[model samples]
Each structure stands twice: as C-alpha cells, then as structure tokens.
Target: MSHPIHALYANLSARADRPALSDGDTVVTHGELIALVERAAADLAARGLGPRDRIGLCAANSWRHVVAYLAILRAGAVWTPLNPRNGPSLNGEFQRRAGLSLTLHDAASVGSLGSTARPLPLEAWLDGLADGVPPPIHDDPAAPFALKFTGGSTGVPKGVVQSQASGAAALASLSAFYDFTADDVNLAVAPLTHGSSHYILPVLAAGGAHVLLPTPDRAAILSELKSRVSVTFLPPTLIALLMAEADFAPADFPRLRHVTYSAAPMSPARIEQAIARFGPVLSTLYGQTEAPMTVTGLSPAEMTDPALRASVGRLFPGTPVAVLTASGVAGHGEGEVLVGGDLARTEYLDAPELTAASRHEGWLKTGDLGRLDKDGLLTLIGRSKDLIITGGYNVYPAEVEAALTAHPAVREACAFALPDEVWGERLEAAVAVDAPFADDAALKAFVRDAIGPVRTPKRLHLMPALPRNPVGKVVRGDVRDLLYPVDPQPLEALR
Candidate 1:
C-alpha cells in the first residue's frame, strides 16, 4: 500500500501545468511544487531524520511552509506544528514535551525558538533542488503522522498523537463532504498549521489552486471572493467582522461557494446574518485537536434552515458519535459527546493516564458537552469545564453567550462566572457591539427574554472588542482579568 502522501504526489504529478500554491510574492505549479517536495524530502533524509523522529515546523503561512509540510511527510518523519505567534515560551514548552530532534523555522521565527530548539531555516531545506527523489516510505496505517496540541485555555496543552489513518480519513471526509472540484480555488486565510491545512490535501487532490494569505485580511479576502476564491475557512469572529464591513454584500461574491467556520461557535443570530450576507455558502464543522475537523459538518444546504442554525451538523459519513450523560451512560440524548473510528486520535504523547481518561470503552471522550438529536444532528452546549453553576442551576456559557449575541446590537459576547456570596458563581458577560445600543439594562432584558433570568447575565459590560487568542478564540480568562484587574477586588467593590 502506498502512503497517502505518495497518492497525493501522484495526483499532483499528473496535473503538472495546473497551479498548486501561491502567496502574494511567489507561485508554483503542480509539477514545480511536487519537485520541490521530493527534493526537500531527500534533503531531510540525508540529514538522518526518519521514522519515529519528531520534526517540528515553526513558521508563518507561506508557499514554503506548505512545501516543508508535504516534504516532512514524504520523508516519513512525524510533523509537529509550532505556531510562530504562540511565542517562544509556549513553543519551547511544546518542544520540550515532544522532544523534537530538529525544528524548521522561517526567517521571522528563527529567533523566537530561543535555545530550546535545534532550529534550521526552512529555506535551507529547499535549497538543494538537485537532491534527487526521496526514499520510499513504509506504509503503516497506525504510524504516527502528526502531533497536534490543544488550545491550553483551561490549563496546559496536551500533545495529541494523530496516526496516518486519522489524517487520511480527515482529508477524505473533508474532500468528499465539501465536494471540491478542479476549478475550485481555496483561499487559505487561517494558519496552515491549524484549520487551513485540513483543506490543502482535499483541494490539491481535486487539482484546485490554493491562494495563501499569511494573515486574515478582510479586504484581500473580499477581493479574492469577488474573483477567484471558491472555498475558504473563517472562524466566527472573522466572519462577524467581514459582515460588519460597510461595503461587503452577498451579491459581490457570485463565485464564492463555501465559507466554513469553526474554532468557536457562531451565534445562531450571527449565523443568520452571515447566510443573509453571504448566501447559502456558509458552513460549519465541530471537532477538537484529538479528532480533528471531520467528526461533523454543516453543509451549505443545511445552513438555510432556521431550525438547525445552532447545530454543528450531522456526523460525517463514517464517523461514530454518541452522547454520554453525567451518570456515565452513553445514549441518544444530552451529555458529553464521544467519538470513535478512524478519524479519532487514540492518545496524548507520553501521557498514558491522561490518554486513558480521555477515552471510554474504545471511544475517545471529547471534553465537549453536547446533545445528539434523534436524527444525529449535534448541538454543542459548551465545554464541560465551562459550565457555570449559578443559584444551583447549571448554565452553559455558550447558551448565555448565544442569547446575548442574538440581540441585534451585539457583535461578539463572552459569558463567564465570577465568585459571588449568594449565587456561588454569578454569571457575568461582556459584549462587543456593532452599533451603539441602549444601556446594560436593555441588553440584559433581551438576554433574559431569550434564555430566562436564571441564565441571563447579572452584570453586562460593553467593550470595543473581546480579547481573543492567536487562533481567534475569545479568551474568557482575559475578559475576567480585564473586568477585575490584577490586585483583585471584592465583587461588590468592583461592581
């Protein structure tokens, strides 16, 4: 059996003249990209990197970054992604944990790795084009392919070990579900190491072009949508910003086909506006680092229905999903979402105890709280750790945030708990608004009407924007810190 990379390379080889990848400053055709990958792979092998070796890639998004990624796989080494924006300390932490023997870095990030990584410039890998074909890769479905990490929002991020089978399944599922075509041009605005990279193989397999944008720029994205881009991924926060643009309109983007969102849930109200502004092209998928993005997907056709607006969509064709309740019963109703099958990762690197707890009876236990409808549509409630207990009533912050964002005035909202004398943990929220609205009382009333008083925020504050991590997830911890400050104050005194 040939490796998945071998199959992808074979596909690219046949489409020699077709455009494969490009940044604003560089471009490579299918044939040229494959040649670079082959040579780079040879170069890596010559340096003694091979199977079971963890190779770290720390760089910004670019054509070279893409080439290095494919080349690393071709060399039969495990690819470990280190986001440059994550800064030196976090990247160093991951490096120490993964025990990376070598790290490939861009010119910009070479200094950020400090002394922890055995850093080499990414350009050095591609320098020897005459390096010849890479050695044949051993076909092992269970072989570790990539090491991905969690967001570390709750605590320290764990390294999720992804097998070759899981990666192939993810690419296949995404490719089939999105229905990519040869004419498709995917605009990659998210980090290639994260969500954006999932679309790479699928698009390439279809002989489609990838337009790489190092950063998500609304103007450039709009420009691409008006012309060449057919498919792209945007987190909910970016989508909200795009919709807020004065000149943005659905009619301008006639060629745009799919605008997928994930990372964080979009408010149902915002989802409605997105559909209205971008047509039926809006889609979403729900998955974490362990399972990747193939677990469930909401197709463009499904977004048109108001009833399923809050749903992440039905499970992918071959994926297995179940909901486990608080009492540890797995069934068809509300509880913690569990996943099984080829797409799920089985372990965290070197952490047997943590890995053991993350699974139940052969299924990977997702820390997410969700409920599966009778038809298999999954509606996420929130993270199990994010559940806020106020007045002895369990209130998921996602529910409260959704309610707050549903009001027309709000653009983004974050719901969190504050220590309180009476309620144990009082629900408090902050929102970034589009247009100026009435005071906190009016917004609080709107949330109260939507989700009832028990879930409604006790105190609402308005900010220009909510703080988000590099990957665009709203940082709830930062919100609390901003509201209360460092020295700490009594809740009554702060209020």
Candidate 2:
C-alpha cells in the first residue's frame, strides 16, 4: 500500500544509474530524477504547500513537466496539469475552481496567460530550490494525488480526482497486462495532460525509461523511434499520417515492441495498414479520463483476428464492465457501456452532479454506446449522446460514418443528426473526398449501395476539409454549423 511517489523513489534507489527520462539532448538518470524531485519538493514546502493543496502547472511536455509532477506528489500536494494552449478565460476559470494558490509555467506559457499572472518559470523555480535532503514522509496510498481535466466531445472540462491508491492500481494493472520491466522504454507522443500520459507513471514505477516527444512532428517522432524508444502510444490520426508519409516497413522500428492507440476508434483498413507495416504490434484501448487506463484492449494477436478486427477486445483483468439500457439493463446486444473497478476515479473535483450522473452505485456510466458480442468482445456503436434518432429509429453515427468512410473516394466523414420539420431528426453527412466524383448523384448512389437506404445520409455536402480539434478529434459543432448553414437559401438564391 505504498504511495505511487514513494514507489517511484524505491525504483530510483534500486536503479540509480539507469536512465529514467529523456528530452532531446537531456537525459536524467533514476538517481538524478529523484534528486530533482526532492529539491523541488523542498522548495514547494518552503512556500507552505502541503497535502491537498493545489498547484497549477501550465507547461508543455518536457523533463521540467515530469520533475514538477513528481515533486508536487512528493510534497504531498495535488498537481493540476493544464494545457498550455488554453486561453486566459479557461485557465482563470480552472484556477478558481481548483483553488490554486501557486502557478508554474514555462517562459512562453507565461506570455500566453497574459501579464497579470506573473508566474514562476519552471526552470528558474528548479534552479532556486535549496540542496537540502528530502525529508522522509509516510506514503499514504489513499490520499488525493492528482486532478486530471478532460472535456471529451462535450467540451465542458471537469477535474477528475485521482488518489494514490487509484494511481498505483492502474499502474499495477498496466504493468501486469503489458509486461513492463526496468529495461523497457516508453515514448510519450501525446500531451501529458491526457490519460495516455498516465501510462508514464507505471513506466516510472517499474524503473523504466521515459522518452518524451512534446512536439507532434512525424519526422521527429520517427527519429526518436530509431533511437532508444521501445514502446509508444499514438492516436490513430498520427499513425495514419506516419503511414502515409513514407514507404515504411515493419523492420523500420526494430526495437519497437508495441504501439498503443486510444482516444478515438481506428478504422479497420487503417488498423490493417498499421499492423501490416509495423508487424502485429498494434494495441487499441478503450477508456476515458475518469478511468485513465485501459478498461478493455484489443491485443496484438487479436488485431489479426478476422472476427475481432472490429472489436475493441476483452475487458482488462479485474475490471468489471457491462452494457445497460434505458430499461435499467441489457446484455450481449447493445447499450451504454458501464465500468467499475480499481481504475475508476473517486469523483469530479467540484461537479457533484456530473460525478453522480456518470458514476452510479460503483460503476461509472461511460456515455459510450457499445455491446459485447456472443464471443465477449466489445464492439463500439457510438456515444449515446451522439446517437441520431432519425425517423423514430436509433441510428448510431459511428456505424454510418464508418460505412461512408469505407468508400474509396471518401477520405473522412462525420454524420450528425439535424432537426427537421417532417422527421423528428434526419441524418446529414459532411464528407471530405479525395477528388470530385463523376457527379454528386453518383456519389450519393455509391453510399446508398454501400450502407443501404436506412443508414444513407439525407444530404451529403462535399467539404474541402473536415474541421478537427487540437487532438485531431472532429469538431462536431463546427461540422453542424457547416452542414446546416444558418442562411442556406440566401446564398443559393443569389447564385
């Protein structure tokens, strides 16, 4: 029952000379990482920061962010990692909600937050710390450790409270599933603010090396893969971009043992391309910010399973998952996915209603709509909130969108329900096509033949590009505004 921070310290003590973290030119050994965290803890303690107190961190993924995170936990304070790219209004709102007394930022991040909050730069803060030895503190596993914020598609970010026990349990489950060891090296490509970065905690706990790529550049990431990185996590969009960039073969990443993907579903074709190019090293996980690690995972072998290619794989060991419907509960067909286990978050920081609504009894009601097949593999339908009730029938947008994207001419597609006078709601699809089809009628006919009449989009609009958020998730709100234009007739009539 040791705290995660304490567990990290133990790993450092066990392998002092082993490399623990790397950022481009800088490499920190386990011993050096411990020293840096201790120094930072001592400095923060001097500022009167202690257990349960919140410290806001607005910095990019770097060695500094890692040191500060460990130090915050070491000093017995809750660390709130903010996206450096967020606007002042959002940052201010988060700071107020979290009751943050001190803020830490890099030089550039400070400028973006305006001049009012003259925050201490992380590098300077680390330099100014005393060289005092870190005092021995009892490791309490149940104490609050970090507050991870996530907006998902709803775009209303809420802080998910994580305790030391929950963190350790997640790390333990990951270690067990992935077979992590002291020699393993994990390359972090996504923002540290997300659940994907939580995988790093387990790597550190296992005394493994962590190489961070703060920038989302494909060439830079490929260069690092050629270096010491063994395992890495990537969203599907990044993997697609990498696959399209070069004539890469499986031998390109000789040392790479695994490539994990989450945050969004990957098309079967894209997944096949990745697996064929990288060998059978692709792993797809399904989970959310409230539960930071894998609720279920499609294993490397399963990726090759013709039957399971469309599945999200079986649930993780020790985690309980089920599908429930509007009539209380359902089984083996389709419903909202519910999860309950060691990895579940305690509660939202300030949003009690959200906490109650999302977490009923002990199971967290993941808004994702999916179901277990006869063989027990989970197949994601779509988010319940994203379900289109068209013509009084439940239509999952993911199913329709997948069907649309399956067309050779379509590059990407997003289907959403729009209000209609005749039907309660009708489905509209905005697609990004690679090139103009023979005609609009021909393209519409192609979709109708591929997905059948019921799932066919009522209206199809050709867009130059589909709008995406920073993390590459399609901005449905923007898509809605585009497909259902405010004044469609004025422009059409003028033409």
Candidate 3:
C-alpha cells in the first residue's frame, strides 16, 4: 500500500459491518464496499489494464460511481469522471482526447461513445468479474490520480491533472473543515463529477454513511432531511430553491448539523432568509477544481452574523492563501488570489505554455481579483477579466452586483464592459428580477444611490433569469451578449 487509497483501505476493516453507501433501495456495508473495490480492481487488471492507465467513468450519482472510483484508484489507475448528462458525443470526444483504454458507464449515461474506449456496462462489468484481492500498487505521491475537468465557462475545457498528494491534502482539509465523524450521515445532491463527490469521501474515511440522490428533487431532499441526515452540500442556486419551496420551521431540520453551499456567490438577502429558515446550519466554501472542498469555508458559526455573510470565509488552517497585487506582494489588501500548498494543481493535462503563465513559482494563480479585509476574510471582487473600465475608473462587477441584488425585486445581476470612444470602455448591467421595477430610470437611480455614479452601467438589460454555467456561477459574457449582438470591441483599437 503506497497510495492514499491504501491508507483508507487499511482503515476500512475496523468499520466493516457499518453501512458505507446507500442508493434509495439498498445499503452497501463497509465490508461489501471493500470487497467490491478489491474485486473490481482485480477484474479490471485481468481485462488488460495496468497501473497509471486512464479509465473514464460516465454515470449518474449512485453506489456504482463511488465503488468504481475507489476501485480505479486502488488498482492504481487514473479515474476520469465525466458528467453523465453531457450526452454521448461530448463524453465520447473527451474520452478520445484523453486517450482512454476502457470506460465503465451506467445505463443512464451509456451514450454513443463511438470508438474511443471499450465500453463496459457498469453492472455487467461488476457481475462478470471474479472476486479477488486488489492488486498491489506503488504509485508516486506526486503522480496524477485523477483528471478532473474544468467548468469551461469562458473557453475550451481542459483536463486538470490532480496528483495523489493533492487529493490526500483535499481529504485532510475536508475532514478538518467539516469536523466530520463516524456518526455523520452525509446527503449528497449535486453531480458527483463536481464538488459534491469530493465532499462525501471524508465521511467514508471517518466510517460514516453516504446517501446518493439520483436527482436533486425538492420533495425528496426535504423527505431525506426528516430522517437522520447529519450533513449535506448544495450549491447556492439549489439552496435558494430549497428555501423558497420547503417549510423550514426551527425544528424542521434539527437532524442536520451542517448544510454547506458553494460553487457560486450567494446573496446576503438569501442568506438572511436561509439563516432564518434553517437556523444557521447553512455554510459556504470557496473552492476551485485545482484545490477543492476546503480553500475557505464560511462556517455555520461564522454565518450566525449576517455582517460576515458577504465575506467568502477565512482560509483553512494549513493552506497558503495570499492576495497578490500588481506589485506582487503577498500582503496586498486587494489583488489576485495566489494559492500555494500541496493541494494546488501545478499544471493542466497538456497545456504547458498556459500552465507556465498561470503559475508563479509553484503557486497556482487563481485569476480572481479580491481583497482580504483587516479581519483576514477574503472577499471576492470579481474575476480580473470581468473588470469594467468606465471614465478612467475601475469597477468590479461583484460590487455593482451586490448593489443590484440588494434591492428586494432583483434576484441576480451581472455587469460587463463594451468599448466606448469617450470612456475607453463603458459599463452595462443585466439583472434577473423577481418583480418588475418602476422603470429603467428608477433602477438606474437605485444603483446610483447604492453603489455610486461612476460604477453605474450606461445601459441596463433586464431579463427573467441570468444564464449560468453548470456549477451555478452566472456567466458575465452571456450578459454582455444580451446587450450587444456583435463584438463590443473597437475595430483594431480596444486591444
């Protein structure tokens, strides 16, 4: 046992009889899970795969997904998890690009993968394998264990190469952040290809049970809450939906200790409503694919104060997070976020030039522009690329959005810039509203009074809902498109 999976495997024997996984109909015990992992690993090797070989898994959330991931790592293969909802063509293209040899897929996501890899139906593969011990693995700590895909909200997606040490550090940070224990029963709702999957592993590492939701239904999750689901994680959009749809008296969710939210910025108004409804169980974390589940957490306790709700959270105990300005000083109050720790990814799968430009001496430069307040809490301004230049002044979209979303009628907001001959660049705002405002003049006046005249957009585009990426972050480019049909740049001049 020379890997992190081995460390987890060594601990599973103590909790062998405990329930390790549940998928609505059946519960798999810790012993059964271990046996399945070992058997799957042996079977995979018998079928001509070897250590460090990449295996693609495209499936909905289920016990099978969890088991396959553990089995792949135990057998010393890289697990490339793909979104089952991405359809067969996109999934197939990604598999082809990754040069995968085999793929295990569930019935729901068994899309036409063309000929990239030999497709094995998930259950058929498991049932057909002969049960045996998992093969021995001697993987380097720095070798990649998983190829996590980026959200690709702005441009082409890239396969992020995450090393074993990074994954181990992620597990450690999650365990410390959540303060999870053997008694915890974690409920998962988001796609496993995203943050929800990583958040559940620490529960198993602590000998707790993980319940998978095939779909994140409002009714079903509320029902599950009635039972003893001690902890869970949902994105802010889902959190807002659940709050509006469910009945949350103080006693409604007593069984839940921590209901974590992330993958997007949450409104303070929504947080106020959630705190009143959920009784302070709501928490949030700031994470990226490079370093996930525990970059920073706005804890349940910290969330008790509404003033701190707007702040993302302070850094975890051992992570190295700094605000580096244009001057490159780590002590800057407002600038780009630089993450340096074993948890950060050093490179993309195949993009060396992009990787070289993105990293500063082994530190992952998170392109987020934000300020760390005197209290040491990191408050994100916006992505540096989203900065709006108007009348020779810098305006961050998040600040303007904060003002728009503060109005009772506004649900979400986005601000973008278009080239202007007079101002160099002009600001335009888009808003998704719950109710109609008086008029554009009234709305502009509201923003002008709330934020300032300098930050106000030259035009406002009101819509039913703002377009969002898969992980729930609002796409500012989409907002820009709503205002300007063609390119907003000046012909050969704006650049």
Give lDDT per model, in order: 0.83, 0.76, 0.79
State TM-scores per candidate: 0.95, 0.91, 0.94
lDDT per residue for candidate 1 within 1-495, as digits (tens), equals 525685556455567899889799688998888888888888888889888788999888889998999888889999999888788878888899999979998888876675565787877656645657798886788899899888776666789998888888788789888888779999988888787888887788788889998877888878888899899898887887787665667888878989999888777778888888888899988888899998899899998998888889999878889988867756578998999988885479999998988888888988888889878899988888787878999999888988887787787888888877788788999898877766688888888888899999988889888886655567777788888886244444423
User: Which of 2 and 3 is ahead in lDDT?
Assistant: 3
Off by over 4 Å in 3: 112-115, 373-375, 470-472, 488-493
Clashing residue pairs in candidate 3, if any?
Answer: none
- Local accuracy of candidate 3 as per-residue lDDT tens digits, 1-495: 225685455477678898989998989998898888889998888877767689988777889888888888888888888887666667777888787878888877765444555788888877777867767875787887888778876556777888887777778788888877778899877888788877656788788988888888998888787677888888777877887786776587768888888877777787777778878788888978877667777889999987888888988877888887777747448898888787785468788887787787677888888788766698888887666777878888889888887776777788877888898887888888877766888888888998889988788888988876544566667667756779856522663
What is the Å distance of residue 267 in model 3 from its true position?
A: 0.6
Q: Kindly report which residue pairs in candidate 1 clash with one another.
A: none
| lDDT: worst 10-residue window of model 2 | 486-495
Write candidate 2's Cα lDDT for 420-443 as tens digits.
656666788888876886567776
The full ranking of all candidates by lDDT, starting with the best, is 1, 3, 2
